[model samples]
Target: MNSPPHPPRQALPTHGTTLTPQAFRTLQAMALGGLLVLVLGWFYSPLRIWSNLLVVAYYLVTLALGGALFLALTYVTGAGWHVAFRRIPEAMASLVPKTGIAILVVLALRMNQYGWQLHAGAPEGTDAGTYWFKQLWLDPPFWMARAAIYVLLWSVLALSLVAFSRRQDRLNPQELPRAIGSMKWSVRLSALFLVVYSITFSLASVDWIMALEPMWFSTMWGVYQFAGMIQATLAAIVIVGLLLRRPGRLLYGIFRTDHLHDLGKLLLGFSCFWMYIWFSQFMLIWYTNIPEETSYYIARMHGPWGPVVLVSVLLNWIIPFFVLLPKPCKRSEHVMMKVAVVVLIGRWVDLTVMVFPSTVGKLPVLGIWEISGACCMIGIFGLLFFKALTKSAPAPKNDPYYGESLSYHCS
Candidate 1:
């Protein structure tokens, strides 16, 4: 007969069992209700509400991309660092599709905001000529099609990877082929998804955010948003990994100091990456001072929004530079939690900076409209994310890497 199940263990400095199902449901309901209020406020302030959702969708896309990319890199490089910690992030990724629908709602609202949907009947000769000439590549139909394709690709890859792992869990270890097959599909799909993500996200950036100032264009915008994704996804994984370390879950013995170190290191590395991309974007614009790029900067640099810029840079890069740069700090669980909190805050600021220049246009309103909408998304994301995570065994038990992961170490 099988032995007794492991007792639910406490996490961190506290002493309590793993999150009970009832408690989990209660927390989820609270968060979901909060998000509902935010979303409902959209009716009164569509631009404000939709813009925030647009940004949220942007981050969600990155989370899934990060997950798919991480899984692929883990498999291809055979990196042992992530094996113990992979599934938690992998599970967070499953939230991508549910949020994808939310994104589509935001996308639909954009067409109405800018009249991008009514392209065919321009007012006259040279104006129409110039408009179509510049925007032929930025048509609304193309954006919708590409966005759908991106979501479909992401959904297939993410769900398939998770489902395949679940299938393997029910079988004997000798059914290693099933797990290997899943890994192989995951790796291949991840590569394709990355390419598609780059193209589609760059295009979507133009359609959704950058197009808010259609005259202003930046080639590095896509990569810039991508950097935010890395930063946010890194924090997300760290947070979830820490949470799942409670006993009676898959991560108890699996998530070791080495795993935490690797996560901390990723947080540090991505912090630098985000800074590099942001500077690269600004440098080209500042040096050339072209009318298009200059306009984008002018909107942000000259007024109430300038402080937002400083906050974005400071939160996204500066604080982390100090917190994560020290070797000792990065390895500590407390410091790592601090790092996650700051990065998450920074990402919110970064998204605000990216869009407020166009939509709010120097308007700095922190009223219920923005607050309620954001609270809703946050609550909903928290609800769906943990819900999706707990549904499975919390980790892939029969995964081929399970043995290596359970005893993961740096030596």
Candidate 2:
């Protein structure tokens, strides 16, 4: 028998488009349901609701930052391989401003949820020095001011990057010189943003999450958060790339398996990095046997929290680490898709472990409230991301590296 002829290839769009109606409606329901849940959860359990919202806000912000940060890294290093799918990260970064608003709202309304805020000026006890320091370091106005600065700075830089990239997309082939200039500007801005993001994000982690237990401190907290952020980011990129590769999608034939394999490598590497940070933090605390330091772990590693911690490790590190180790797995879209989902879920679980123990109690709590809050954030993120994605070409055809990116392959 003669071999069957290949099916005709579908034409792809050169520019972005609106979300399908079904997608829009689905995201709409998720957002509405989340709002309803928040309202109901508020009445049912006030503190719990607030705590969940805090988790959602922080989680959303970090994910958005991860997108922008990923873009900055690619730009600074002159990585051309990502240019074909750059719009996805650009859309992700677009969420920074929106999430910034959510975070500010959470901080403003639920400022007292944090231990530092609650006991900022409480009567001094045995640890008078510590109390005094909390009073100074955790000052509410100062804290809010710093948060505002972070939001403003991050929003401006992230938006500028997106804006510049979009502008470059409008250029024609003959405008290559101008496109090169834009790329140069992107590199300079990316470098500045990287330095600024490093210091600000570290302080932000300390202020927002680490300050949850005022008496406990870990020097490794920032790096730990960074690892998780980048890991999830890589997984997210892989997921989006795979999704876009679906038939009739923007990246139908543009985003290839080679890109997927490289992304898998990143996912695997960062999964290991996340585990490293987790162990380093745990080992140092266990070794020192210091009350202040151990107190943080005591809450998390004991009681109902113990199992949750275990689950977090398995989901965040163990699963992704082994799943993507094989060369074939990385190139298989199905395998990579599932692993990416696991890593993203693991990220949420990790965040839950970090936020809840500090806010709720030693025992773990999961209910409609937490679920609803997450749904709301995810829904909003999808909507905003799609909106941003539609505002420009799905890929940068005018970038100097666009051709190189399209032909990118791993030996």
Candidate 3:
């Protein structure tokens, strides 16, 4: 059968746009308010402040990392439809350096809780060989070194790719030779980033999160972290895209219903993927009945934590799956935006469940510290993301696939 005809390419404005003054002021206020709130939390409860900071730091880092991963995946797959919306992910990825700094600050403040003291002494009755291995591997200095390496590698790769793309944007649109060469370099760097990310991100997850409960181990933990990361990243992209679609905005008219549909489909798929990983980890532990492993879930599944877990499942998977299952809903900006907001909240809840159980235990204290810390991170991330967005065009106008992306339509 013949392929469906491509829609006529739409004309986008030639000049690049920046965030409006009103929006900039709003974000500035949020940043300042969140900072003040965080300070209050710090003075009120240092432990809670640090714990929430850990959650915020890891969550923001994953979003930035996942944004880079999204770009790499699109390049590897040669996805033309994403070209028109590529700037959102690129800008999000640009926050990597900032996130790395935030993570380091959190670690420095809370080094005592993150496997530092445990390396000094081994558990009784454990084999000397195995104990030494844990001690060496989990040493604070080694952990810090690995984190620094991961951050440096990710920042360099992410910035390099964005720089290449931006350079092409600055060139004449007729400069196909240079643009194509730049695109090829982006693809090559993307491949390298993906390979490095697969290992380093897994180790980072184990170090930053799983190490909190050093006794608990799940073979699927890394993949589990990856699943949430992608889901959350997609949601952030969707939210930003919707915001940019408003009248008189830079991205207005660039993204249509089909783009929203594509994004919703991804959100739905990853929601299920995250749930599958969650269940797989849970089932294995429940089935094996291993005390070491089950203790992790028991802490989360019992007491006040149990309801939070159930709500997380509903918010992350059930709501998005059911809501986006319908074609019309996926295409509706209103519906998908709401679903994205819910999924984003669910992502935070999921992170809370993971971090708090190990740090705060069953007390279930959700107060100013949690609220203010989250606000602080969101404000900071928003500021960085918007600042980066202003540094380049809203879309890659010189991209080889620009026309194809503009003309994309579902069959």
Per-model TM values vs. the true structure: 0.86, 0.94, 0.94
Of the two candidates 1 and 2, the one with more favorable lDDT, higher being better, is 2
Residue 382 accuracy (lDDT) in model 2: 76
Ranking by TM-score: 3, 2, 1
Superposition error at 115 for model 2 (Å): 4.2
For residues 1-411, write the lDDT of model 2, one tens digit per residue: 221221223344554334568988999899889979898878887778888888888888988999999999999998998887898889889889989989999888877555544463554333666666676777788888999999999999999999999999677768878999998999999999999999999989888888887767889999999998999888888887777766666676677777787788889999999999999999999998977679888898878899989998999899988888888888888899999999988998998898888878877988888889888977877788777777777778788897787665664
TM-score of 2: 0.94
What local distance difference test score does each model get? 0.69, 0.84, 0.84
Candidate 1 C-alpha error for residue 107, in Å: 1.4
Which regions in candidate 2 have their CA more than 4 angstroms from the true location? 1-12, 15-19, 115-131
Ranking by lDDT: 3, 2, 1
How high is the lDDT of residue 336 in model 2? 94
Error of 1 at 17 (Å): 7.3
| Better candidate number, 1 or 3, judged by lDDT | 3
Any residue pairs clashing in model 1, and if so which?
35-376, 38-372, 38-373
**Which residue pairs clash within candidate 3?**
none
